[model samples]
Target chain A: MKKKLYDLAHSRAGDKGNTLILSLIPYDEADYPLLCEKVTPDAVKHHLKEIVLGEIIRYEMPNLASLQFVCHQALLGGVTTSLSMDTHGKSLSYAFLQMEIEV
Target chain B: MIRIGSGAGFSGDRLEPAVILAEKGELDYLVLECLAERTIALAQQRKNRDPNSGYDPLLEKRIDLLLPILKEKKIRLITNMGAANPIGAAKKIMEMAKRKGIHIKVAAVTGDDVLEHLDGQQEVLETGKPLSKLSNLLSANAYIGADALLPALESDAEIIIAGRVADPSLFLAPMIYHYGWSVDDLDKIAQGTVVGHLLECAGQLTGGYFADPRKKEVPDLARLGFPFADVGPDGTAVIGKVEGTGGFINLATVKEQLLYEATDPTGYLTPDITADFTTVRLREIGSNQVEVSGGRGRPKPATLKVSLGYHTGYVGEGEISYAGPNAYSRAVLAGEIIQERLKDQFPDLRIDHIGVSSVHRTYFGELREPYEIRLRVAANATDSENAAIIGEEVEALYTNGPAGGGGARKYVREVIGIVSTLIPREKVQTQISIQEC
Candidate 1:
């Protein structure tokens, strides 16, 4: 339910649209080692934690290994916003499971 | 006043229905269609193998048809032709225009290719492969949306060159400028984009790859047509192929094309229109054309991801069907003997499922038990020749090894590839500048 990750998350540099497009961009295999060096365990933890909020925790999905955070923000706000994106490889789906909000 | 127009699909070729319609009818806007995943991969490989190949730059080939018209009609254009090398393409277009004494000013949209620019920053998903795995990753492009075209339009450039923008927006963009359409009017924008999408692929909707290719009775086969978008002030755009062409359209052609690449009609995705594909309706109006109307859409997805593929490695796979109760044991022995023989020919090759569970049992219909076992062998080889050799190696099993070789047996070889890619959400769309001459 975090706004930054939901609103601001993007494909890394050179990959400007979505996750799938980044992977689709023909990249020189020489740069692959650079990718391994960048995915340090700490980076994942920090990035995942940044998207976490009250009653919302970050979790990676099965088979996808994609970072996702579950939340009750949709329920708390008494409003629903649903968005689904498919990139032959990456996908995102979310709904309100629970919530808490004041007027 | 310069009338800048971007079309829906491939209308310039004069072979597709879109082009036929445009040539037959009078229109201000004609868009062509040419972007897909398979295409992206093909174009990228073309550029990867040879940077100067100009495989991705759409405008270069696009100019074959466009240049003549722009000169004839004295019109302005904007297009997403910057597939691989936009700047290179722009240079070519400029050179062509100069020969005709046309002072062509083209705005090449740059800042999109981020592959080489990543400054020590790169990330991929869990598969554990990043930019490095793509050892030969030569080029990268994102499916940039319509907004990218704004800069070029404002410049009043004689032509605007682009790469990977949403197809509809390519046509809709000029409409946005001509009609002064706002971003908030999601409905109007969606309507305009549909016109673009409908005509993007030349023969797709125009009867090229229609359900029944023969029903339309198209004219000339050699000059396959392209698509054109003719939009009015109200956003009611009429789509058609070129005149003097072969293909004809009825309600069926339009309806089928609407459903092309659609599992759910209502969710047609585009940067400009989150089209409501569910309530779409089309009607045949004339002999060779149909009127496309009544498709509503929602807002665009928050994040649009570009797709990419990497060559993981070479894979060799094949299987054989075994019969009888000794299927499991026999399949195992067969695999072992095959691997042993292959190892000698293919040194340092890795063979999986060599012995254990070499066979999977299955039956037809609902109620079925392990009817017979199908044994499979998959090997990974660095060399391409090994793949064909492995097939011959596995098929040889029936004659040379194992006890219950079964009644009917065979081996098939298929190259295996482990493609690993990384896509961060924000970085999916890339913008590259198409320089002008």
Candidate 2:
């Protein structure tokens, strides 16, 4: 069955220069491996393809049951330069939650 | 164990929460992490206009309110509220102390401002753009680390003021000073950095920004308590909030903040140490209590990160709301009309339907007929007049375009864009000076 990523996990996004770091943490420790299998860099890259301009890199920490996706060239130019109201890309974290995953 | 409480997370974090901590947390040091991108630039500009007014705007109010409570509680303060002018901020605090007929020692950490030494030689990290390209550069500050702040901890300064130190370093410096930990203690420093990062956001680890209704179920969010750390000699700390205060402190909140703004879990770079949060563990020892351990660290970077601010022209934005049936269509029509009118003048104008496509513009998912929608048009340009034209075009939509378009708002402002680069550590010098009260 298809389930929204938000149903299984919670994430937070923060900006650095022009990159957006989205950290995904599963609610259930048992579901961590499932997230590892389903939420690939390619999946996230394709999921946020509209705004992501550069490459996406994922760093996994099974110890913490969390994954961090570094999305480069994601912000218009980031807080100091971006014209977006959400210049820090604070709202972009939810964009990852929109991903559909089979649980 | 030395208790360190975060009084203010950002420049504008609520003060009431910090008051709660001062009265109850039994903190040895209350660190306030302020100053974010271009904040120093704005502070520098203010100082240029008036010599005495370059620090955090709320510095006086914060000091005035927290002085009696924190002083009686013996909770010394260390803050980056100096923004662009540390010495000036220190002097102002001293003056405030004098007026209140109180005796206090204030120290200012200076030399982070390296605008004069930039020489336009460094390249911006984002665009590989040279610093010489900016004609109207305002301020440039090197992110000095925990070492610069050591003298303040050593001295008898009741309040320490600093400008542009790395945010995490504010919390780490006091930890290093209190624990008598050597600068070379990478592992301990790493652990200290972890605590700093966790508490640096103030309430994030305690649930100020984490509530999502049924998804997260944070209680008493209205009175969300700020975070404090109970650090042991080895730098292991338990992160929690005050008793009977609002907000939840748990593993989920910690995990969320753990990776917040993190580039690499194993190599989260800071001026003091490169911390590894990969092995960090969180345990709920009690209600509103989570012990954090296992954070490791490595040697510091050879160079320091510099935040450079320059004039980036102007930005103009306009928003008009549409409600009732067909709100989305009317909002879309308003957006199209504004774009069509201003496309020639402001070729880079962006139009977004607030409810339909403001953020994450890609996936609108079937349009679901929002009861209300706001059409926003924004553009950036080299001149304020050109930017203002973008908003003017949008405001004209009130009578010329979509029906039921109300609540029009338009604004044009100067843009202070920030660029970052690396500077050799030896090029900058840091110092701490005590204000004669």
Candidate 3:
């Protein structure tokens, strides 16, 4: 499970050009872990690292321990993009199903 | 030309830009969306920080900006900038308009900020918390139905101003009066609601930061174009964006906008329109235009929407990063230590989640478990001191232990709580204020 999450994170993000940012504004942090399950611990830490890029917007966490994490940035298929590299086949498929878009 | 045109836009601490658009287009009616659900606390916060800051933005600034424009342009506008402060908004608008060389007739419509008025008048579809608890609240602005717009309209004032009315009523009120459509005329009201809904969010439908966000090199989104409706007597209306604008609109844009800020489609409720979204059609026409037609709305509900969030306790946390060889392992140890200790202190339990990435693995991880665990432990103590003490104790762990990698402390304090409100469409609806400004 750990290896799969790790590989998915690398192959999908971390190249460092296509910056991806997520804002935890849903007013609940309970579902945050569930989101990061697909990614490795290292990837989560690296992206959420305060020093990474321009900004990482997280909400509702007033006294936040770490402003950054290897939380999954994906909606369904997995963490989508940012900082690394990965084939978006799973991502595209997931979105296609969720929205039923023709693409 | 006594143009009876109708459209939508924004109204916050300012209504100048909206008046400019109305005057430029020679529009007769303008709808402005000022208040939102999560904004009351924001309003309160602003009030606390600067007694004249929060709601004043929706009033003081509006008067200075619009008074002059109202004098120059003979247009009527309505706004829902009045959350717990319509009289404040109205008084400013009236006084400002007069000073700006405009002899504007205006009336401030109330009956929406019913933190008190919702006595037996309230019914709860959810938990039924009752209007009493809601009273004496920091602020109360009901989402009024279009029925509230009647007063503003009946006053025959060149402009009618109101407090915390729903966003749609800004447009619906004017349409009802011009078309003489009764509030109960669900179908017509639905059309008006549809128009208001489409135009209420302003540049959103015309391609603002939408859900299906399309990044267009619009001429200027900062000075974004608002929506307008050519509402007819039958409740049917033609809606479009500004003329010679950069963005283009069509059925797709309307549908995208319709579903952009999405919720349960069936549960779409605003005080003005009882119509179900299932009944409308978006027919494309000119490049930036779509005609919104066919609406079958329902009757207004008895109760206003409820905005509820209680004073939960306080919480705080600290952060330290792990980077070297055993960074991941060290991070986990740190999380366990905090969790184990917190268990003895606060049983609610502190939560820690771990994720890691590398140059090779991207963010999810590189073919293995996370390389580093970002540990975050949180606890709710009886008081802020209790919460801060726990957070500080965790901060100290990094200095003496292998688990801490980054530093001695990264601590911050704040009251975190879930803010939820199930306001009926009626409670959040914008009361229409058709002021000549």
Candidate 4:
């Protein structure tokens, strides 16, 4: 079955310089393994191809059932210089949650 | 156990929540983490214009509202609202106390401003270019840690103000002081840092930013209460908010805040300690109460991170709304016209269909044509005059192109760019000056 990542996880995005840090956590601990296998850095890079212009590095926190994606050069230069309406990219988390994952 | 409440998270956070915490919450301290990345830089710019005006504009207003309650409650106040001018802010507070006939002791922690220490030859962490390469540099301040704030805390000052102190440090300094924890205790400092990181954002732990309607509902967001941590001697704490106030604190809220801006889970670096978030534990003990413990840490960094703000250039923006049938297409046409008209002058123009895809640059799921679409055109230029042209051209679209282009608005403003560098810890000096009224 195909299910959206939003069904399994919730996310919040924060920015430092030109990098966007997006934290992904599963609602159920049992779903952690599934997300870990499916939501690879390459997969996320492909998912937000247009939005992120740099590398995406994923850091896992097994204790918290969370995955942190550090997307570099992603804020379109960053909050101070970015011309985007959402300069902080606060809404990018929702965009990441909308990704389709196989269940 | 000592309770500490977060008054304000950012420079422009809601004031009422902090007031509620000061009045009702039984807290030993109230800390407001107001300095953001570019905040002090802008403050420095203001200081350059007028020496006494660089402090947080709301410092006076915030102190005015909370002073009486804080005094009655005997809650020691700590804040980084002293951005670019800790002494000036402290003086203002003392003056306010004298005028109001309130007895209070205010201490200003200075020396975070390391502008003179930088020769501009150092490399900028973001661009990897020599700092000298950047022109019109405005400010440079190091992210001082908990240790720098210890002097003021030890002085027993009722209010402590500082500039460019790391966000978590504002919360951790209180713990170190009250617990009498040694600065060398990396594990204890790390745990305190965790509490600081979580509570520094104020309402975030109590659900100010974490609402999603039916998916994740937060109650009474309008009256969302700020959070406080009850810290024990061991550095473990229970996070809670005032009862009967809006917003709920639970495992979910605590979990979200645990890694708010923590880039690395294992190696979240602050000047006091390199905190390891993976070691932390979160459990819901009761309604709106979560027990947080098990945070560990490694040794502190050898150098402090400095945020440098410089003149980037100018940004010109314009927005116009199109309505009724074929609004999306008409909005797209209006954007195309602006792009074609200003391509040579402003080559890097950005056009956004606000209603459809302004945020993420693309829409998710099925796309439905919005009845009302707002067309936004923005671009950056070397000078304000060139930037103004971007908006001027969009304003001309009212009659020059597109049908029903109503509610057009334009803006042009200077942009400040922030970058980071590192300075040896020994090179930065901190001092404390106390004033009583």
lDDT preference between candidates 1 and 3, better one: 3
Q: What docking grade does candidate 2 earn?
A: medium
Ranking by TM-score: 4, 2, 3, 1
Candidates ranked, most accurate by lDDT first: 4, 2, 3, 1
DockQ of each: 0.02, 0.79, 0.04, 0.79
Query: Which ten-residue region of model 2 chain A has the weakest summed lDDT?
Result: A77-86
Best candidate according to lDDT:
4
Predicted structure 1, TM vs. truth:
0.57
Q: lDDT tens digits, residues B1-437, model 2?
A: 98999888888888788888999888989988888877888999899899888999889888988988876888889999999999999988888889988888898999999987888878888778888876788889999999999998899788999999998999999888887899899999999999999989898989877889888999898898998999999889998788988998999999998899998888989999999998798888998889999889889999999998888899999898999999988888888777777788777788887887787765535658889988888898899888888777777888998789888888999988888889999999999999756
lDDT of 1 at B325: 72
Per-residue accuracy of model 4 over B107-145 as CA lDDT, tens digit each: 999999999999988899988899999898899999999
What's the TM-score of every candidate structure?
Answer: 0.57, 0.98, 0.63, 0.99
Candidate 3 structure quality by residue, lDDT tens digits, B41-77: 4565555565544553545555555556655676776
Stretches of candidate 3 off by over 4 Å are A1-103, B1-20, B41-58, B94-102, B117-140, B211-223, B244-246, B260-267, B308-310, B313-338, B341-437
Recovered fraction of real interface contacts per model: 0.00, 0.79, 0.03, 0.73
What residue pairs are clashing in model 2? none
Clashes of each: 103, 0, 67, 0
Q: Candidate 1 lDDT, tens digit per residue, B231-331?
A: 67756756655566555565544543554443233466765557764444455566665665565667776654344444434545556656667666666
DockQ of 1: 0.02
